[model samples]
Target: MVSGTGPETVPEAEFRSYYGHPVIKRPIWHVPHMPLYLYLGGLSGASSLTAVLAGLTGRHRLARAARITAALGASTGSAFLIAELGRPARFLNMLRVFKPTSPMSVGSWILAAQGGLSAAAAVSDVTGILPAVGDAAALATVVTGPLTATYTAVLVADTAVPAWHAGYRELPFLFAGSALASAGAAGMLATPRAEAGPARAVALLGAAVETAAATLLEQRLGLVGEPYRQGRAGLLLRVARALTAGGGLLTLLAGRSRVATAASGLALTAGALCTRFGVLEAGRASAADPKYTVVPQRERVETAGPASVPGR
Candidate 1:
């Protein structure tokens, strides 16, 4: 409290935490592994959705490419996740009980189901076996695919990290857009240019959505969003935005050119990866800074008034 002649004349308290330490512990999720998992999980989820849609529309080559991408992404992503857990059993242990209220639990289940279904679809596509079962599996992924793409956003948003928690409204859309862009990139890369028109369209749409969501998140978050606009996180996100924008334009003008398609696909893939890494870095930065945690809380208390404050 400020020393003043009267209460009304006192200045507001400056924000501080004990001994300059962070008010909340920084997330222990390791670099590369966690971000890679996030990217690959989104890729797998969106690829599955693309595969199902392409198949329904008679784009067999595109569908096959998406199926393969979905299977590989899911399997590889799960490996990264298991490695992060330090044990495969730890990954399996999460499936012992279903908890609807737990985003991690729900995400684990979605990942498992998506992985299995995508793998089945890919195998059937490659081997020309179990066509009926493959169709069923591919169709089932429609239910799990969108959930898998966006659930990680929920998982992170549930945490206390100001960057993640405060942007909950926009994070899911951001992740979903990134996921779609990733899958579309994979489809474009794997399928022939002539057969990849829909993939290009998806990539363009995803880029638009991703860019809009990211802009809104930063704008709406105000001070809490500083981490995303400064430091390593800012650099990465800027690169992501540039790459995604360039890739989207390339896809728009690709015009049956294999080189342009490949270039756009590669750019989009890199942008999506950068987005995941940047988001993680922003969350870490926010968690490490005391101001991000304290300012909003103080503002909330002040807005609610002394009568509503706890322990008053």
Candidate 2:
């Protein structure tokens, strides 16, 4: 409505005045649901890592837990996502069509595949059904697991939220690493160190990824990524970095026994949770500020120069 060929048409002195709040629409969902999604995603990823390790080491029990966890995590996460959508039945529209540009579409399919595979793998013990199916499911888990761990970053980034979208590359890698670490940690506690060696390796890898990804995220964002680097997000990120570092160290010393592995696992899990929640909060904060959005747009306009007005 305020479009003009020249800046003077709106009166250069009459700067745009923002209303009381920044957003045009309020987020309908509650906090628990979003964070629940974060939890489910982490759980699913962790379970996948567990499954892979278990299969590799012939630790069926750990593998069982991994399969069950992945299934449950995917189930719970899907429910939360549907609930967050405001209408459960409308969720089907997500699958009615596909769009690679739409992170939700990609994520939904990823989740569906992960859930199906996880359940199939778990049902091997429950129904005494098919061992072949179980093995197939286990194989599927190895592929879908990383997507489960990482696609969430894309989902969050697809939003209009500047903070998340800007950190896209780093966030996905970070989440994937964290997921592997958390699951491996859980396995270490549940199984012997000899069997849980993969878990330790996962934890160490996750810690390294988390640290590097976080650093890259901050460095790459510059001013646009300021929301994540300051205030509550900043605090959470610092904690995550510390946890990852400490956990990686613990993982390296995992041969010391189950206790060390357990500690590393816990640290990695904490780091994963922190990263997810922190990113969410940072997005909200970025959206809440007019300056963050306005300044950038203004600079762009100034750089582009005044536009030509048809009637002027």
Candidate 3:
């Protein structure tokens, strides 16, 4: 209706959404409990693997320590998971049916099997009630251990969470490395210095792998990686990388003294915990921001060309 303008033409907008609402539903998982569960689950899985390796190498004391660590971690982690579920009774229903397509279902079954195996191995080691049975249980963990360590990554990444789903390819590696480092740290802490060589090696290797995977994930993700570099998540990730890198370096020098070894192991464990918390926090942040969801979908649509119809 302007006198100078022939017509009041509205400019076409490139993208549209409903009132800044999130396109994807956010995960309802609570903090501390969920992150703590992830940390313990990784610890349990990695310790199980450490136990198997120790047993094979005739490092009986280390094997015993690993069994104890696995059992304690799984048992404690299950408690956190149940707390997250908001009811202990619901946890029992997880075993009613096995759904391979559902990560939660698969993880439940895996955790159940792991709990039984780790508990048996730990008990036999403690009471000498059934040494043969304990050895068999420990051996069985060789199958479940890797799954236990890596499946949480699958569980988290197989979601609508932008940061988690986008980084699915590298998440497993990150988680597995964290698990191995945790197991190694626990083994080193519990075992005598003379027998902690394998643990030290595992810790260093895991730290290196974890650091590399995290760097690649951040670099390759571009805009999706923003959440990881902003706010509390960024601080946590930065701390995690620093601790992991420093811990790995310190572990190399740990051969000189027991105090140095203990310090390195503690640092590695703390770093792994921080990594878990950071990843979870990043996902939460990504889901909270409408820009993360809307912009990505918009890019995909634009890249798909004229023939690409919406809502396909």
Kindly indicate the candidate among 2 and 3 with the higher TM-score.
3
User: Against the unseen true structure, what C-alpha lDDT does each candidate score?
Assistant: 0.93, 0.75, 0.89
Candidate order by lDDT, highest to lowest?
1, 3, 2
| Every candidate's CA RMSD | 3.4, 6.0, 3.4
- Scanning candidate 1 in windows of ten residues, the lowest lDDT window is 1-10
Model 1: per-residue Cα lDDT over 181-269, one tens digit each: 99999999998887787787788888999999999999999999999999999999999999999999999888878898899999999
Q: By TM-score, highest first, what's the ranking? A: 1, 3, 2
Write model 2 residue lDDT over 183-260, tens digit each, in one string.
Answer: 666666666666666666666777777778888888987777898789987888788788878888887866767677
Steric clash pairs (candidate 3): none
Which of 1 and 2 is ahead in TM-score?
Answer: 1
Clashes of each: 0, 0, 0
- Predicted structure with the largest TM-score when compared to the true one: 1
Top candidate (lDDT): 1
Q: How far is candidate 1 from the true structure (C-alpha RMSD, Å)?
A: 3.4
Model 2: residues >4 Å from true position, as ranges? 1-17, 23-29, 125-128, 301-312
Per-residue lDDT of model 3, residues 155-274, tens digit only: 999998999989999999999999988899898889988877777777888898899889988998888989889899999999999989888888898776888888888999999999
C-alpha positional error of residue 91 in candidate 3 after TM-score superposition, expressed in Å: 1.2
